[model samples]
Target: MITAEGLTKRFADKTAVDDVSFTVQPGRVTGFLGPNGAGKSTTMRMIVGLDRPTAGRTTVNGAEYGRHRAPLTEVGVLLDAKAVHTGRTARSHLRAMAATHGIPNSRVDEVIDITGIGSVAGKRAGKFSLGMGQRLGIAAALLGDPHTLILDEPVNGLDPEGVRWVRQFVRHAASEGRTVLLSSHLMSEMAQTADHVIVLGRGKVLADADLGDLVRAWTTLGVRVRSPRAAELAAAIAGPAVEIVTTSPETLDVVGVPAARIGDLAAERGIPIHELTPTTGSLEDAYLALTGESVEYHSKEIA
Candidate 1:
């Protein structure tokens, strides 16, 4: 598990990370999400001791990451896939990292196969594609078989297949009781992979909760109803607190009412209902709603 308490970082005139606190529990995949310049990268750097926190503390497992006897065995981190030496081969890079912690050549070979980079293991890092570089970085992280994994944008340059592989890999790791903290801009994939999420904005903790609860809290619950008597159904459900939007001649999008209630109302009125589907909010919806004001860079809509 990873724990941070009042973690803060300042770079000269600006605060890169404000007082932030969150726990990444074991046996579950926790997603780290934020917009650009939200201090997510800075926070991750502080967690692994790449940058010293100006205040508070962060611990991997039970102590500071640097204090671990074998840091690699305790935590595996991949903040930047392109941090490898450009002159070295993929295999050589992994071999060097493993050698630092006395990890054997056999384990290095295993990670190469595990990350599906065996074909490119002998190729120079400089010549590898973006996807290949990411694979090599992941292989190095898994070299020590650590108890905790911290990955930032692991799927940044991956293809569809590689993206799916990462989703499954993190889920499998968590199932085995390993702590996994993942950062990604892909909300759809994060929604499918993470059990919980910690959101940061402007270097401060904006929200932290289970993924389902976060979505429900930040977005409206609605039910999509399709019926020939859509207008009548909308009128029936209309109230001071309820909202009904007409999407089509035969369909209505409803809020402040449950699907069962809508179905019951339709049945009572003898209205023919073709479809009554409950539509819940998604992670993307929640993220946007929660971080709307926290966004540092805004792009105007194009005509």
Candidate 2:
């Protein structure tokens, strides 16, 4: 497991990570999510001892990452796919990393095959495409077969097949009792891949919970109503905290009110209800609702 207690980092007058604390347990995939400039990269860097924290500390398997004699065998990290030497081939890069820890050539070959990069193993790292570079980086991380894995945007440039392969690979790693903490901007993929989520906004920890609980806690259940007198029903239900949007002449989307309340109000008003369905909230919906105020960069609307 990985633990962070009051983890904080600062660069001059700017604070990159602010007293963040969380645990990434073993046997599950924990997702780290944030908008741009939310300090995710800094936090991950601190975990691997790349950036020293200004205060507090982080530990992997009960010890600081740098304290381990064979750090690669304790934790594997893939912070940047393009961090490799461009002059070296994929095979040479993996071989160099393995040689540092006395990892055998057989293990290097195993990861190359496991990552499905055998065909391009001899290709120059600089000439490889983004997807292929990501594959080579993953192969290096798995070179040690560490107990914990920390990957940042592992699927950033992957194709659909590559994305699925990563998903399955991480799940298999967790099933084998390994700790996995990964960061990604792909909300849909994270929803499908992560067992738990930790949300960060502007260097502060906004949320940390199970996937289902996070969705349920942040988004309210909305009701979709189809009635001929949709406008009338909307006006009747309109009150403080109650929102009603007219999607069509005969349809209304209601929020801050339950389906039962909407149905009862419609019946009492003698409105002809054709459909009354509850809309379940998605992970995207919850994420947007929670981070709506914390988003730093906003795009201008096109006129």
Candidate 3:
């Protein structure tokens, strides 16, 4: 498990992270999400001790990451795939890393095969593609068979097959009771992989809860209604919190109200309703709503 309490970081004139606290337990995959310049990278760096927190503390398996005698065996990290020696082959790189903690040659072979990099084990990392580089980084992280895994954009350069493989692999790791903290911009993949989510905005915690609960908490319940008298129904249901968007002449997307309420309101006004479907919103919708104001960079459309 990993724990952070009152974590904060400041770089000269600006605060990158602020008073963040959360715990990642074993046997589950926790997703870390945020927009650009939201301090996600900084927070991850602090967790692995790459950047010292100005205040508070973070522990991996109940101890500081650097304090562990065999740090690789306690926590596996894949923050950067290109942090390897470009001159070395995949096999040579793994061999050197294993030598550091006295890891066996057999383990290196195991990880190479586990990450599906045996075909290129003899190739130099500099010549490898982005996807191949990511695979090698994962192999190194798994070299020690650590109890916890921290991966940032693990599928950045992967194809569809590779992406699916990573999703299943992380889920399998968590099922075996290993703590996994994953950070990604792929909401669809995160929805399928993570059991919980922690959303950060402008270096502060925005929402942390079960995946479903977080979405429901940030987005208002909405309904899609198809009616012959759509305009009449929309007018009847208009209120302070409700909004009606007409998608077509006979269809309307109503927000801030439940399906049952819309149906009742339409029926009361004698509107001929054909369809009334409820929508609970998606992870992307909730993410945008929660971090709308926290986005640091915005592009203006050209006229």
Candidate 4:
């Protein structure tokens, strides 16, 4: 498990992370999310001891990451896939990292195969593609078979197949009771992979809860109804507690009422309903709503 209490970081004139606190439990995949400049990267760096926290503390298990006797065996980290030496082959790179902690060559081969980088293990790191580099980075992280895994944008440059592989890999790791903390900009994938979520905005903790609870709290459920007499049906159900929006000439988007009730109302009004579909709030919807005010860079919409 990973624990942070009042974690803070300041770079000269500006504070990048501000008194953040959250606990990542084991046997589950926890997603880390935020907009640009929200201190997500900075917070991950602090967790792995890449940067010192100005105040408070964070622990990988029960102590600072650096204090572990064999850090690699205790926690596996993948902050940057491009941090490897340009001159070394993928195999050589993994071997070097393993050597530091006395990890045997046999284990290095295991990770290479596990990450599906064996086909290019002999290739130079500098010549590898973005996807291959990410694979190599993941192989290195798994070299020690650590109890905890921290991955930052593991699918940044991956193809559709690679993305699916990562999703399944993290889920499997969590199932085996390993603590996994993952950061990603892909909300759809995160929604499928994470059991819990922790959102950060402007260096502060914005939300920390189960995935379902967070989505329900931040977004509203809606139902879509299609009929030729959409306007008439909408008017019949219009009230202070209900909201209806005309999406198309024959479709209405409704809120504050269930699909079953909407169907019954349409039937009672003698409206010929062609379609009725209920839409629940997604992780993307919750993310946008929660971080709407915390975005540091805003792009003007194009005409």
Candidate 5:
């Protein structure tokens, strides 16, 4: 298990990650989600001992990664695929990382095959495509066969096949009771890949819970009712708190009110409803609803 306790990091005048706390347990894929510059990369760097935190700490299996005798054997991380030496071949890069902990070449080959990078194992790292580079990085992470895997944007530049492969690999790792913490900005992908989600905005965690619970808790349910007297019904449930947007004639997007109340109000007013259906409320809308003004960079178009 990977646990971060009150983890904080300050860069001179700016705070990157502030008093963040979350637990990543084994037997499930815990998704790390946030928009760009939300301190996700900084947090991942701190987890792997790449960045020094200003205060607080993160521990893997009750031990700081730096304090562990065999760091590579404890946790495998793929922060940046291009961090590898361009001059070396993919197989050579894995071999070098393996040599750090005296891991055998046989193990290196094992991971290369496991990540399906065996075909390009002998190709130079410089000539590999973005997808191939990501595969190479995954192979390097699996070289030690660590119990915990921290992958930052694992499918950033992957093809469709590579995306599917990474998803399956993540599930397989967790099925073996190994810890997997995958960070990505893609919400739909996170919805499908994760058992739970840890959402961050700016530098703080806004929501941390299961995918369904987070959606239900943060996302407002919007129901569109097409009634003969739409305006009359709207006035019945009208309030400053309730957000109402009319996208079409005789249709209204109502928020901050339950569907049952809407129905009751319409029935009382003798408004005959023809269409009442669930309108899609986006994940971004849910995030904004929960965090309010905490979201970074609200553009004119987005806001």
Candidate 6:
């Protein structure tokens, strides 16, 4: 539903986004992930016509976002939940946004109710909590009932319940063939919410693939073995794929190899094995491995 070709954006001498290209397809939630200075917000802003790209361009459907007669109806964006006027009531905020597209007052109430902000509809937005404010922003975004949603760090202040709600919300929207592009730096949250993941580093695309098959690095995919003779077991398969980091005298933190092989080696050498377990990799590990040298700000003391 959304496509970008060689999209580039510059600020002064620094390139915020550099020849980045990707697509957000319909019927799935695509995650846009990167480090703090990795141009995620800039890319999102460009997609919604908030910021102009220095080179190349992106299109929602077949036309540039600016060319769309009803942009609000084409794409619903929640770039900044706090961008609302504090003096206005929640309902008033929705009414004002709906007015832009000439949507009726009843539609405003529909979105307000859909976002579960009916009780706070009359309350001043300045007095609302962060989660409540986020709901209000989502209400505005949904007011248009757009087919595409571009949300940047949407779950920032949401509680666990609200977070779950947002996740299901996106999934439900995508299930109906809508396109969703979500940006977040939180690896765990993205792991849970995104169907397809795009990893970015230093204003460039690092990895863009399905969330189901994150690169092997993201997950060490190792097996753990607890044998009585840990020393003998370590000596048998002492290769690059097998590393026995010391945790305790009786236990070894084995990584990079399968548990079955470890068990086979142990049984062959008469080493008694006690425990075998498989360990999965985390999104952080995968992201770090993918962008190890491409990070903009590396710690001089270590990395």
lDDT of each: 0.95, 0.93, 0.93, 0.94, 0.87, 0.86
- TM for candidate 5 is 0.82
Candidate 1 global lDDT: 0.95
Which of 1 and 3 is ahead in TM-score?
Answer: 1
Clashing pairs in 5: none
Q: How good is model 4 by TM-score? A: 0.95
Against the true structure, candidate 5 has what lDDT? 0.87
Error of 2 at 118 (Å): 1.6
Give the alpha carbon lDDT tens digit for every residue of 15-56 in model 6: 989999999999999999887788888998898888999999
> What's the C-alpha lDDT at position 127 in model 1?
94
lDDT per residue as tens, model 3, 227-265: 888888989989998888999999999888889888888
User: What TM-score fits each model?
Assistant: 0.95, 0.90, 0.90, 0.95, 0.82, 0.90
lDDT score at residue 247, model 1, on the 0-100 scale: 94
Model 3: what TM-score? 0.90
Q: Model 6 segments beyond 4 Å from truth? A: 217-219, 226-241, 246-252, 269-275, 298-303
Cα RMSD (Å) per model? 1.6, 2.4, 2.3, 1.6, 3.5, 2.6
